[model samples]
Target: MSENRIYLASKSPRRKELLQQVGIAYEVLLLRDAPPRGPDVTEIVLPGEKPQAYVARVTQEKADMAWKVIQLRGLPQRPVLAADTTVVLGEQILGKPANRDAAIAMLSQLAGQTHQVLTSIAVRSALGLHTVTQCSDVSFAAMNQAEIAAYCDTSEPYDKAGGYGIQGAAARYIANIRGSYSGIMGLPIFETCQLLEAAGVRTTTDRSL
Candidate 1:
């Protein structure tokens, strides 16, 4: 792999778009053929696991899984990056809704309330493992049943944490946000680049001294 290219272990289109926005070259690592190692490797939330800790743990697991895939496939040893994002209201962690009704319920609860969006990123490379988390507070305006139903009908919330995508139709529902907008979208570009640089991956904007 070239110095400018890394391996992205996630299958999220949002994460890929974020990386492209920052001009970071990356190749998607194939994990379909990779052996199933025990559990899903990144989805279970242990009992009493703090939201922050859960996201961090999941991100690390993703990176570790990607590393194993690299070794198993004999792929070039480039930095492998993975991330996990979660929505939290107090101690409750809201992951991707399982269905339309669940998405509606999650969105209704978030209406006119302030919640935390935590995104944790982990990168594994020859330099070692580096991880960082970005927490952003998002406040939503009061939403009515009609609005919620209409939004959910768009079918955009099913695959996203907290049952809504900040960069999608849900943007109109946001009254305020305090923190990285990109983080709310899935990946925080600033923190991602920081970890990438620390892992010795070069970006297009990096200048060699």
Candidate 2:
């Protein structure tokens, strides 16, 4: 395991849980207390930005923003980890639903369709900063309006990108996936572990490298 302490720059419990699953000890650093970045920076997808580009850009932006926060606050400068997830349908990329109506529309479009889930994680440490992108192909069964409405009523889809979560109640809608299941859930263990290790975030499985 890494002898160095880790500072997680995210509020996602799933990421925390995933880190713990891999035996990586870390401390949480919420952005709320990390000072504001002027205002809520609407993560821009940019004009004609592809899903891969958007995902990687956001992940780096988040890590870079958090690094600035650490420097400004003089917080214990440990490795800062950040990530972003997106759902891509053909050339159109679907991010989090802006409202209930948007949620319904997104779910309807995703009904009985296969979409690409792209997750990017960036790790910043004393060694340097490294970013990794993981892609997953997820297929969903055709769903009715009632199904979409019922799922939307819960807390599952609102905060998740692509309007759904593979590990949440929305799991029932997924028929098959062709990539990292954990990536769809938000973080891919294989890629995340690799990035962390490269950034000098030590783990028990040192020999795996």
Candidate 3:
């Protein structure tokens, strides 16, 4: 049993890649699919809930749920990590787009403006649950209808918050960024490292890699 391994509760490829990049040993925890009519929605922003609070709540909830799964499955006793990211423009929180039109609308609103990207990472262990939220400002250059249309054609916007990914073709559309780049990708490296460390998970740096 590797003492450095933790259970990751996210299915995000980006999160997996980020963990690998940081040399954090992790095992993906498979969650049962939610039924279509279930009331277990994780993205319903409460009335008057701020973006920061919403993301933090959701991330902790994910970590809590993942921990429960670990106990149920009798998986190896290890810390479980989960994260959530959202894009905020003013008071509105832009979540993952539901369709092409929605994606286009999101990108359109984000064009020529700066928005906040909030990523909350949570880790649960026998000691308890620990969490951190990191915020970053991303500025998008003014984009025309043609540019938006062409980018939307690739369907990259559909899976990302704010309808654009800073690491992808949308990179050309970004004018500036003032925070952790990994936070925009889904997991904020610094904040994630802090949470993992607090949960007693040794990081790559601790191993002197």
Candidate 4:
């Protein structure tokens, strides 16, 4: 891998920290003027767009957008990475809350229920784009208004999918997790490594420098 060929198409601190934790040196590739948040509210998933399909579509779109940015900027070609995460309760897909009231309602609905966290990561290289989607089932213990309000008052849940973060104070509400913990946090470490490795995004210091 070239020293400057790795680009993270996101500004997510969690995603950045995860990549850095594994010693992967990368530059940020912002997808759009506004940060790439949850599901594109305006994107109408086709009639048969299942959760997995919807997520894959968005993930690929984000990765492709980053690639377009790099191309438009006329920077030396390199690999760009992008990802999307969604929280689902049965057939209902939950995105970031629209407001405090919506957040409270989502939290209320999630209390004492189990939901699936799906995180998909994509990488675009000269060869082609690679992607991986990981799913983890998380169970949340019952939460009261006090607990929800306390967690919501902070910035932890607002930006995260499902309106809660597994690594933050919201951890208190999670009874247990059955998949990649990092996935719930936004990026699946194992799957992300797979995508990077496949795209030749090496983590060895030998390559980073």
Q: TM-scores of the models, in the given order?
A: 0.94, 0.90, 0.93, 0.89
Off by over 4 Å in 2: 34-41, 205-209
- Clash pairs for candidate 4: none
- Steric clashes per prediction: 0, 0, 0, 0
Q: Compared with the true structure, what per-residue lDDT tens digits does model 4 show for residues 1-209?
A: 45645888778999999888878778886655444332332344678678888888888988887777777777678888888889899978888887787788889989999999989889899989898899999999999899888777887768878888888888887898999998988889888877877887664557436
Per-candidate alpha-carbon RMSD to the true structure: 1.7, 2.5, 2.6, 3.6
lDDT per residue, candidate 1, 23-105, as tens digits?
Answer: 88889976665464322574888988899999999999888878878887777899999999999998899999999899999
Which residue pairs in candidate 2 collide? none
Candidate 4 stretches with Cα past 4 Å from truth are 33-48, 204-209
Q: Which candidate is the best by lDDT?
A: 1
lDDT winner between 3 and 4, please give it: 3
State the lDDT of candidate 2 residue by residue for 95-167, as single tens digits. Answer: 8998888889999999999999999999987677899899989999999999999998887778888788788
Q: Candidate order by TM-score, highest to lowest?
A: 1, 3, 2, 4
Query: lDDT rank, highest first?
Result: 1, 3, 2, 4
Residues 1-209 of candidate 3: C-alpha lDDT, one tens digit per residue: 35888988888899999999999988997666432221242679989899999999998888888877777666788999988999999989998888878888888999999999999998999989898899999999999989988898886888888888888999998999999999999999888888888887777565564
